[model samples]
Target: MEKRRLGRTDIDVTSVCLGTMTWGEQNTEDEAHTQLDYAMDRGINFIDAAEMYPVPGRAETQGRTETYIGNWIEARKNRDQYILATKVVGRSEMTWTRDSENLTRQTPAQIDEAVEKSLKRLKTDYIDLYQLHWPDRPINGFGFHSYEDYATDDMVAFEDILGALNRHVEKGNIRHIGLSNESSWATMKFLQVAETNGWPRMVSNQCVYSLVARRFDYERAEIAMREKVGLLAYSPLAMGMLTGKYDSGPTPKGSRKDLFPTFLGRYDLAKAAIGDCNETAKKLDLTPTQFALKFVESRQFVTSNIIGATTMDQLAENIDAHEIDWTEEMEKEAHRIHQSYRSPVA
Candidate 1:
């Protein structure tokens, strides 16, 4: 329920941001509305969504997440009550994201189309934070590690991406800008470009950060500390691996891992680390869910921890995690797990 300043922006967002990536695919429209209502009632003032959501990213259900949020906003008529954040897809082969395209890149024209569609789907005049979903450069994001050949010519340049976002800021379509799945170099370059060009500054970086994945600590943490673009950590529970429900040999039925096995690859590599997390939580007399959720939520460098759930029970447990007092023992246990894993998934 605590709020924090997002970089140098006047916007104040809650440390616990409600994530809605699963809204249309795993959950129905009513369920999405229920989650929104419950989250607001629980004092969560920040909601994060994306244009390419309800994951698995099929052409059929691509934009349903924003539609659900848009309906909720229209029904509640409290758009000003929450800090809304959404992203534009970076270089991707999923061209169905754009009606006439087979490949989507963060080019200026594509950015214009993306924002216009996102605004229409979200039913909002302005987004509090508009994010580049990923980098346009050839890089292994979404957990891929092996290097792939980069095209000699790509559709968009980094500055062009920033320039497009800046134009939106000037036009009031977006209030601020942010990035996700980006490297420390790109983060600093974006900041540098903004400073040199007198364009809008990026307010935050959204990435995967959990007890099992502490790779951010290696370098991104420094960028956050020195550059002021704090982290908006998604998958803070590592897609429910940190919750320990899957440690009894099988992933729980109806859980995220059970529903989407491929998404849990991060946990697959660091399965032992996750087990260590569960064992440590038991030693601390806490549920693995509580321990893992609190461990990420209590981090000093985390601006906000994005929590997702398909059911009310899961949402309640995630929300209650904030109430648990983070003890020294838990911190030490988190560190021990990190030491053993050394970012096995990153």
Candidate 2:
């Protein structure tokens, strides 16, 4: 596994990161710990989670993912072995995450509350990397091709958000700060504000980046290379579209598509392109999983490719994809797919 520097920080995370969004929802506590153990044995040292995880978030299963991870940390008693990363819900209706607040905004009090709660759940004094799950702004970040108008004035100030996170850093609640599902302009703005205040910089941008989803390549990729806020590519498999599991026919039983099809509605926007990508993978003599995962790992701006799984076999295959050599022919095929599709999902 290749190690890359996380932003300008001293941390060097593996090119492959273990994602835990499906841990509590699709899998059990033992399964989450099993995946964590296998990932560490495979030389992967980065773990990504969120406050609103087990995807399809609800009040019942909220924060269960972190609780499971905290259990693993307690059992292993080796918190220093790997770097743990988690996020706070940003500007949403996940009010259950807070003590008494109705809305989950990135305000100072909310951030403070979120940090303390995450620390308590994660069973750690300090988080290695803390991220805002999404921007506090009122924009449709969930893949609206053309920007729909939103009230820009009705949002928390960037300075306030950064200041809140900086306070957590100062208090030893988190080591670094990051962003997710953010726009190019917002990323630059946060970086600039952090520089001005001499606060902790945004180390990485966790966004959708796969063979079928390449919106990050348009502008944020440059920000990643130049500013060091590199891309922590999530959904790098297009939610299993790139793996060819949904290529032929009906959704596999008990799979993500079978369990929660609406969660994959974003990929439905680029169905034809996704099909072509899977076809391209076969033409290159690579499994679609290897093709998709390696493509994201090959990007210059990608700090780490976040891979998730519900079973050991899928987890092993995802990690094995990192070992394959990304060839020029593969890159050319990926480019051809991009030219035809042109990021329809975004």
- Which candidate leads in lDDT? 2
For 1-346, candidate 1 gives per-residue lDDT tens digits of 8898898888889999999999999899999999999999999999999999989888899999999999989899999899999999988898988878767888898899999999999999999999999988877777755658678476376678889899999999999999998888789989989998999988899999988778788889988877879899998888887787777776577777777888776567787887888888999999988898888878777889999999999999999988889988888888888877788777
Clashing pairs in 2: none
**Local distance difference test scores for all models:** 0.88, 0.91
Find the 10 residues in a row with the least total lDDT in model 1.
Answer: 146-155
Q: Lowest-scoring 10 consecutive residues by lDDT in candidate 2?
A: 143-152
| Candidate 2 residue spans exceeding 4 A from truth | none
lDDT of 1 at 207: 91
**Candidate 2, number of clashes:** 0
Per-model C-alpha RMSD: 1.5, 0.9
lDDT score, residue 68, model 1?
96
Give Cα distance to truth, residue 5, candidate 1, Å: 0.9
* Model 2 lDDT per residue over 275-344, tens place: 8988888888989998999999999999999999988999999999889999999999989988988887
Compared with the true structure, the alpha-carbon lDDT of candidate 1 equals: 0.88
